[model samples]
Target: MAPTFYHRWPEPVTEKSGSMVQSQCWGWKCLSFGLILVVLGLLVPLIIFAVRANSKACKEGLLAEQECRTVTRLLELQLAQTRQDLVGAMGEAATCNQTVVNLSTSLEMEKARGLEHLTRREELQREVEKLKEKLQKASEEAERLRKEKEAWSKQGETSFGSSSKLLSPLMVPVCLFLGLTALLA
Candidate 1:
């Protein structure tokens, strides 16, 4: 027979050649798949770590913003309270000033009344002094009249011894008249 296709490409040679090529191709394919799997696994963890870090940063920023807002509200409240206190203090000071003015006016009125009373008291004292002087003069005049009456009665007694009994009777009448006049005066 002439050289056939099967004979030229013999069984042993074909088997050996095809087996080596197939094994090497299959091994290289498996190594490529393993490398792909490892790269995918590493990417999953890295993606998870990056997402957690970003979330944590966002939460911190939100917390800081809330704190700042709370502080701002507190400061506003404090400022308002201070303003109210200042207004109250000013009102109290005005009321105190009015009270002082009223007290000063009352003091002036009281002083005027006291002066009027003092003037009246002085006038009454002068009237009392005048009455006392008049009483003293009346008492001195009464004493002088009593001494004159006593002297006239003694003269009548002395004259009665030398005169007649008729003269004695007339002298009694005269003495009676003088006594009456003195009492009347």
Candidate 2:
């Protein structure tokens, strides 16, 4: 006959079943823990990177805002300075215009005075010419009168000479009257 398989003691079914169940439970727990660890690892770096990016963006925005404010302040200051310069230039131009007006007035006054002086000088020159003419006429008249007197004196000497008795006293009076008439003429 074939060698018969000997029947040994029966396997412990409860123990084997319990041990398998425990192993399966432990495997699921280990898998869940590993998955959790992986997720946390990924999330930690992502969160850190996001925070760093946000911080950099905030810093850049703040710097830009500060620069804008500075530029605005500089523009305002430049505008104010330009306004002041314009006002000063206008004031200087006004002063120059007033000076020009004063100079014009002075020039006009000087011209008028010059004209008056010229007129006065002309009038004086005319008066002097008139006086010279009058003097010349008077001198000529005096010279003519002197010449007539000399002629009468010569006639008297010739007609009445050296003989007061020959011409009588009556003739002497007549001769004197004639001499006076010639002198008057």
Candidate 3:
């Protein structure tokens, strides 16, 4: 026969309530709890690292956004200044164009005046030439009349008698005076 141990009274059935302390399930509960603690322990550091990385990236993104806004503002101001300068340059160019037109008109008027003065001077020169020719012809006529009067006086003195001689002497002085007047004129 094998040695056997036996109790006279029956033990209580504590496992039916599902309580770990009263049952043999304490080891299983402890094992499950330990597994959860290990998983949380590893995940906590991973979550902390991800959070730090996200925070740094957010800060960098904000800084870049601020810099972009500042650059955009500067470009807009420069564009406005360039536009203003362009407008001023256009106005100056318009004024210069008007000045050129006015100068051209004044030059045309001056040229016309110069032409008129040249025409008047040519007319005066033509009139002077005509007057010089008329003056030369008048001088030639006076000299021919003086020669004819002297020949007539000598012929009249020989044809008349002694009574005519007294008249001839008086007429001689008168003819000489008239001849002198014609030459002076």
Per residue, candidate 3 scores C-alpha lDDT tens digits across 145-179 of 44554565566755544445555466646655655
List the global CA lDDT of all models. Answer: 0.73, 0.77, 0.73
**Cα-based TM-score, every candidate:** 0.41, 0.45, 0.45
Total backbone collisions, model 1? 0
User: Least lDDT summed over 10 consecutive residues: which range in candidate 3?
Assistant: 134-143
Cα error, candidate 3, residue 182 (Å): 22
Better of 1 and 3 by TM-score: 3
RMSD of each: 19.6, 19.9, 16.9
Q: Output the lDDT of residue 133, model 2.
A: 65
* Candidate 1 residue runs with Cα over 4 Å from true position: 1-69, 146-185
Residues 54-130 of candidate 1 have per-residue lDDT tens digits of 89787799899999999999999999999999999999999999999999999889999889988978876776566
Clash totals for all candidate models: 0, 0, 0
Candidate 2: C-alpha lDDT: 0.77
Q: Which digits, one per residue and each the tens of the lDDT, describe model 2 over residues 1-185?
A: 89989888966769787898899999999999999999999999999988886897877998999999999999999999999999999999999999999999999999999999999899877766765565555556545645655665567875544353344445546545654554344
